[model samples]
Target chain A: MISIDWYLALSAILFCIGIVGVLIRKNAIVIFMCVELMLNAVNLSLVSFSSHYGNVDGQILVFFSLAIAAAEAVVGLAIIIAIFRNNFSVDITQINLLRW
Target chain B: MITYSFIFLAVLAVATALGLVISKNTVNSALFLVLNMVSLSGVYLLLQAQFLAIIQILVYAGAIMVLFLFVIMLLNIDEEESLFNKFRIKYFVAFLLGVGIFAQLIYSIGSFSDTLPVVSAQMAEAGTVEAIGDVLYTKYSLPFHIIAMLLTAAVNGALLVAQHKTKPLTEEND
Candidate 1:
């Protein structure tokens, strides 16, 4: 009963929340979670479009994206941990060694 | 029928997202993210992409998040306090960017009604796993390989980043 439009709207709102998380949170771990949220939002839209058209390719693509997300989370979390250890804090503001 | 459930899931998803943003406890945030992912899996099911829904649950809700929990627990994150400030401008700019993207998507969807029917007719198959495998193997082989390579890259990159160097730079013992 949920129209494709409704699905799209839900995804849009979720995507916006993810964007806000990425923007407002300074913790790298939180930021990474937001990135995952964004990916999930896109996945929702992809499945909706695939179903709307009856195409399976879009659904398949979600698998690939999920794999990439896993890799990203693993890599990102590691870097954050390493950064935390090096700096003794995950406060993001204190770990500004790379910034110009 | 499903619209009611859709609204329900939407509420759950938003609530968890708020938790993810505001929760001071890292483990709590991770748990909220799991809740969010589970609701997203429900969204996929509603879309009729059964395969994708399962993957969303298994990979995202199950595996990746457990990994997050492990790190949070192993590191024992809570005893330390997180510092609070200096990025107000960054947050405002990112909010504006999100609004811009949403506006453009709404505009495009509104303006392009004519192409909808054709797109729908083409996608009418409600993509099955077999159908996807066939198309990806036949029509989109190169992109598939590229995606594969990217996954490999991300995995390798992550593993490399995670490695901790125990050896000291001074090497006095050696």
Candidate 2:
């Protein structure tokens, strides 16, 4: 039997990589991608725990998370487009108009 | 066999995630992210979350990635720009902090290695499409409806916000 611990460890590593990516990446879109990665990591752990407990709640939660993530992608990408339209750049460092 | 599959998929996922983060071109990053999502869907299948696995591919790999690609092309981002913007001390400190957190997590999880209960077959089978559908429409029906409304609102709002601005051409008269 493949232990749940392996899945949990994988989830944790992926989450950390996402965190590091968020910290170091400069592009707004790449940052958004990192956020998605983090969300995926969470979903992995949720499914792992669901399987561990032998219940449907975790998978149900994953379903909801996936839906919400899609919605977020729509809104977030739209916002990114709007920003790009005005600024002519998607670099996070350069788009600091609100950095008072 | 399952263990090997898990390792392969996990490695694929992490590698693509790294590629997504480091690739200079926004389009390349988006492509790498798609790979990551597909690998994750495979992981979902291994976990016996069959419905979620399909949804992961359909919604995330299919829908969301296309959306990202559209945005990437629409923006027409220049690829000549440097991938890393700033290499300041603050970012280094943040990296160190992240590593610390990762170490702590591994240690904490490692300590409880033997305590996790083996999953029951009944619970494992509960991840089926039928099982999820029954529960979703019953116990989670209200939340599901609310989410549907929320998605509708989000679509409308995105359309409204992304609509092209039409400013009057003041210089045309000159």
Lowest lDDT 10-residue stretch of candidate 2 chain B? B111-120
Q: Tell me the lDDT of model 2 at B163.
A: 81
Separate DockQ for every predicted complex:
0.56, 0.72
- Give the per-residue lDDT of model 2 (tens digit) for B37-120: 899899888888899999999999899889988888888873737777576875787689779988998888777567555455
Q: By summed lDDT, which 10 consecutive residues of candidate 1 chain A come out lowest?
A: A1-10
Each candidate's interface RMSD (Å, one decimal) is 3.2, 1.5
Q: After superposition, how far is residue B63 of candidate 1 from its true place, in Å?
A: 1.3
TM-score (chain B only), all candidates: 0.73, 0.87
Tell me candidate 2's fraction of native contacts, as a decimal between 0 and 1: 0.74
lDDT of 1 by residue, B1-116 (tens): 57777889989998998788778888888999999999988877766666777878999999999988888886777433652346778767877988887777666655534334
Model 1, range A1-100, lDDT digits (tens) per residue? 3447767777777888788777877767777888898899889878877777777767777877898788778778888778877876677777767877
